[model samples]
Target: MDTSSTPRSAVVLGAGIAGLAMARVLHDFFDAVVLVEPHPLPADDRPRGGVPQAHHIHGLTARGLDLMEELFPGLDRELEDAGTPRLDHGRDVLTCFPTGNAPRVDTDLGSRLSSRALMEARIRGRVLALPNVEPRTGLRVTGLVTDAARSAVRAVATDDGGTVPGDLVVDTTGRFSRLPRRLADAGFPTPPTRTIDAGVGYASGLFEAPDQSWLALIQPTVCPDRTRGAYIGKLEGSRWMVTLVGACGDHPPADQEGFRAFADRLDNPVVAAFLAEARPVSPLHRYVRTENHRTDYHRMPAWPDRFLVAGDAVCAFNPLYGQGIGVALEQALLLRSLLAARTGRSTPSGPVGVAGVAELTGLAREFQRRLPRTTGYAWRMSTFQDAIWARHRAGRTTRRDRAVTWYLDRLYRAAAADPATAATFARVFQRAAPPTALLGPRVLLRILRGG
Candidate 1:
């Protein structure tokens, strides 16, 4: 490694949202940044072979939209130009609470709804246009190149018969990353991992929308006997992305007729109506691997100095909550800030370079600290809800369970009638506001007043 180089070199593994965003941020500090992906990059909005979830619906929450705007200025306009639908979360979405049917409240917080492929394609285009960023598709990283002491990653060995050397390496390989095992093989201890499985499954299908600009309806079901939920959203090109989800023992079937029956069972008639009117553009895509998994690599006593993991590789959450893209964007911003702090103070070759290493380690630790709080909250909430539903299905209910369910019924009814309460729920959904906000005095008053 030549410290005298005018700018640093960075290698980012995986060409997903996290990898692309990290490469964009790395370009600010490093002279060159390389992004490696396994599949051939798509030249248009067509799906790539890499991301299996591209067929599923993806929602950019209000908070995620804000983060995306900061990362890529004018991204909203770009998405709009590309036919992505902009939705007012409270206004456009008619949310049906489990307790009872109430008049839907129209609030103002907005979210952008689009196909995962379209959103990724837009971001990938901008990232590839960066002068210092190069995207190399169809090349897979087989192993890490380490020094004689095997203490630091000197480069990465790829299937393409070449070594891509850099000052740092980041693994953004999603949930299937082998970086942790690779690091352990290279002499580091295996990192601590935690996983919570709720046995949730997803079935998604694409259809042509009846209207061009109307927001898609999302109906969340809480069948104590079934523990199922469904979501529908409008995607680019006037297409509807509908996903039917189930937790615990209630699973959506992969067969077309069975999936339609599941959608018809939803508390709301909108999903069934849309399915009847719209023709399926693709086969029913099913995914049953939804689990909350996280690795504490930064907590390791002796992690490789030049390597770190980000995105789903660090923490993968249940996609039902739609936190994947938002978390990836936040990780990219954090990485950018850490690198900027290092570059602002000293040249790449100056001093011991110890300070840069320390800064990077601290950034990794900060991310690890936040990981549990983010993923754990969703994991607990989902599992707890699912457990309650399971018990209800089994015909066993304690007094405490009955009381809690009653309170939640009241809260949902209040949320539908009160704008302030609805906003609080929206914030929590977006991960922009803490769960404590739901307990605020104003919201409590509404719940008490029978709103």
Candidate 2:
């Protein structure tokens, strides 16, 4: 492995967080990296066609913030300068957990609140600044170019009648990617698929936040009878993005009055209060196109060389968990490490060397392994908590449910009073730290002692 050798070239599909992050990491290992996006990405804080969920509220968990900082230093400051609200999770925002109605003690590990569109715009600007990276918008990727043997993909075809060849191709095309279909048409067997439809629906609209007040509250009410949840997140420019979600056939209505009524029914009053006081900045945007879907690409009997899929294209979680962006960032970090490990090794000049292809394939496989543990946890948590609401709706009461709810209630109350408990809970909620930390001996003792 010679460190002085010219780096490889790579192409990334989509310009969303995952795609942009992939391109950013690829720039470090490749002499030329091109990002293909189908929509014209804006230079300022406006919505793009590619990300339909742009109007929705987005926040980085403490762990995600740390990873982003490691990937691009000063991103936090950049976001702050752009008017993103930096929230101390324990102190600034109040969260009501399902375990109990007692408010959790707030801690200091803060989260950044902003619109998904704003964050995407900022990251895109930084990514485009790299000399070795090129982003070409409005070019749709129609298919992949594979060798006659069909064991590997060599290039990607675009609707513009042009081809972009690369040593590696990473798909960050989000949940709507047609790569699996294209691959199946190319004689490749479709990867195994899994779907869990909680029948969730979302309706979001931007509204003006009160002056001098930071609106970073998330009140997730679990209603067993109706199976519904709602969230309110503060965004930049003094606006707030509120979403009303329903599950198991309780879809949120799209109209103005219907939407507000749904918010009024949530266990938490925060969303309804904001809706009554704030003026709407945008029309209600509704999303319910896909359930939680994931493909086991790594477990495939065979895969094309020089091809890998990342981001939502690989596994899309229930957005209510707010894990999509964080997971994507972690994937990019992993991909960067894989490339760095392969740096000095011999590679096939004509196409990705067989060994090089194997390495990349392994990287994609590792992502698959990690997805279940990540998304699966959130999926189960959401459904399980929803089940409690369902039980309440059914007018069923059980000693077990009561006990669990009691413990959770005490935990939240303690969190609101004890900064240590609050910070620990925030870390777990952000997915930046493990949930087991909350069950530690000291924490458990406090919970038993009723804080």
Candidate 3:
């Protein structure tokens, strides 16, 4: 299965952040990479047909920014040159967690906040610059083409009956991917799935803000009785992106008055006051696809040899946690590491690392198995609060739920009173440290002492 002579080819589905990142990594490992997209991509930072939430606020977590910089060198500088300032999480940003306003002690955790389209454009430009990569836009992936044995994906069939053949295929087609149906059609077992539907909805819009120095003012919806929240973040082009969010079937109205009313419902009056005076730059865009869904591909007894799934196609989390981009970048980095280790490449690029189609079987399975572990903490962090809110509304709470609720309540109080505990909280929230770090003996003692 050595791919020493003939160059290895790869077909990556979708042209969103995940797809672009995957294609970039594959370009380093394969001889040729073909990125297929269903929509015609614009050259500028404009919303495309595929991403409905493009106008919404998107934060590149500290970890996500680091990974982006690693993948495309000088990306941080490029963003800064474009007038995107990196704000310190504690010093420059105001965060109102569910437990009330988080303590704003200066810390190293921070990220560059920008509209999704702008960030995507920068990454997309870098990805397309790779000589080994080519993008196929305006082509829908119908299904996967397998070899005679039907065990490995040999090519991807497009909507027009054309097939793009490749040595390997990766699916980054986002949440609405047809991969499950395609796999079932190929006589392969579909993966097990789990979902926690928060029933959250939001209305996002752009506004002209005089202030352009800070990052964001976030007030997330608290649990129990509170169901409304707001986020006002600095976007490119000297505009502000304001989003009013509600969960558990409470949707922000798309109309101007309704949007203002929703913003007013937030605990903080700052958002509503600002919206009252700030000039609206865009119509209120409503989005309702906020659910935590995960497909356990690792549990499948059999997997296609040359096929794999990443990003939202595998695990889509609630947007409130701001972990989507971070998780996607981490997944791409993981894919690169797996390929490099398998190919024995000193670095990501050089000679083709994969030996043959047979080798892909193990790599695909291993990747799927390891992918769940990467997203477990993030998934838990998102679903836990949503579950608490859901159960609070239903008036049905289990012992475990009460225990978790009690522990978190005390933890948040401790974080507000103690700087060290607050830093630990920020570390975990930024994904620099594991969640277990917050549950340690010292943190528990701090909570017991009523910090």
Candidate 4:
């Protein structure tokens, strides 16, 4: 992995956020990087055949936004100039719950509230703009070409009966990645899998509404009490991206009338009132694959050399939690750190620091094992709430999880009244801070005191 005259090459699968970030990182360490995707990517920000969630609402967490800015310098300004609305979550987003609405005041958490398509388009555009990076759009990845001893991935097989050789191959194909089967076919060890499907479905639409009260409206789904949720936000172009979510078969209908009806069913009247007057700009799009899937690659007894997995392919969370992008960004930063360390780069180009480089095993193996240290919290933050829904009980529900949920309920209720508690809640849930932030003395005291 030496950056000096090693002439390393990398082939990254998928064109999603993970793949884009990985390609950017590989460009730093490798002499050449090839980014491959099966779908025909359009120049504009339109939904493609591969990504089903492109049409839905997607928010960048405060930390994810910061990481993206680091990965692609001046991206924040670029997004803002592109009409992506930047808003402080504490004040710009009016959050509601079954009990009531939380007070919107000044706090630290903020995001560039753009549609997923727009963000992806911007990131992919910047990534592909790199001189050393090559793009293979519309080329399907059929399988992996293994070495003679079948110990490592030597190249990637495409649908056109061609192979793209590389020193390293990365899988960022998200939840539906075929890397496992490809590994098994190569006589390599494939990891065990676990999934927690909440049966959550989404119906989203675009609208043009003049609601200056707040930049976004969020009514969260707190199971057993609230099964329906609404996220209405204005993305670039002054157009509103309204996404309605329902758990346990309570899906939102993909029609104008039904979309409005679902919004009206929410406890908050703000969501319905805004949509009631908005002009529909697009038809509703429904997405139903919101399961929490965990592929235990870190625990795999044996892993192939020169091959690795990252992003949703390893740990895909429920989309409702908005942790997918944040986790991917984290994984991207981690990749940079491990790569920079392995290559003996004195300083990483980004703002992210390589703090734990000396303790790593190999780059490929250590990436998978150490990832859970950061990703596990996001996974728990997402899946814990969904586990309580009578229909979402797929994983083991221990007494600890029940206790965590109980405390989270209290924290949610407290967040409704106390600004400090709400800010902590926002930071923790935003992935800007750790879960320990919720258990801090002041926040813990506020939660215990019944804010």
lDDT of each: 0.74, 0.73, 0.81, 0.80
Tens-digit lDDT string for candidate 4 (154-254): 78889999988877788999988887898887787878998777778899989998857889888888755577998888899999988999987799999
For model 3 the local lDDT of residue 18 reads 90
What lDDT would candidate 3 get against the real structure?
Answer: 0.81
Model 2, poorest ten-residue lDDT window? 345-354
Give the per-residue Cα lDDT of candidate 3 at 76.
Answer: 84
By summed lDDT, the worst window of 10 consecutive residues in model 4 runs over 351-360
What lDDT does model 4 reach? 0.80
Per-model TM against the reference? 0.87, 0.83, 0.94, 0.91
Model 1 misplaced stretches (Cα beyond 4 Å): 101-106, 212-214, 221-223, 345-407, 445-451
Selected candidate, larger TM-score, 2 vs 4 = 4
lDDT of 1 at 146: 84
Query: Which RMSD values do the candidates have, in order?
Result: 4.0, 5.0, 2.2, 3.8
Writing each residue's lDDT as its tens digit, candidate 1 over 1-451 gives: 6435335678999988888888877776666788888888898878878687898889987888998998888988999998887887766776666644334455556778888888888899988888878888888888888888776787889897998887888889998789887886678788888766656788898887586323756555453444677888888788888888887657788778899888777766656667778888888898988777878876788756577688899888777777788878887877766666655642222122222344444444455455454455445545445456545656666777777666666778887777678767776776667777877898778878875
lDDT of candidate 4 at residue 115, scale 0 to 100:
83
lDDT of 1: 0.74
Residue-level lDDT for 299 in candidate 3: 96
Give the per-residue Cα lDDT of candidate 4 at 181. Answer: 91
Residue 440 local lDDT, model 2: 85
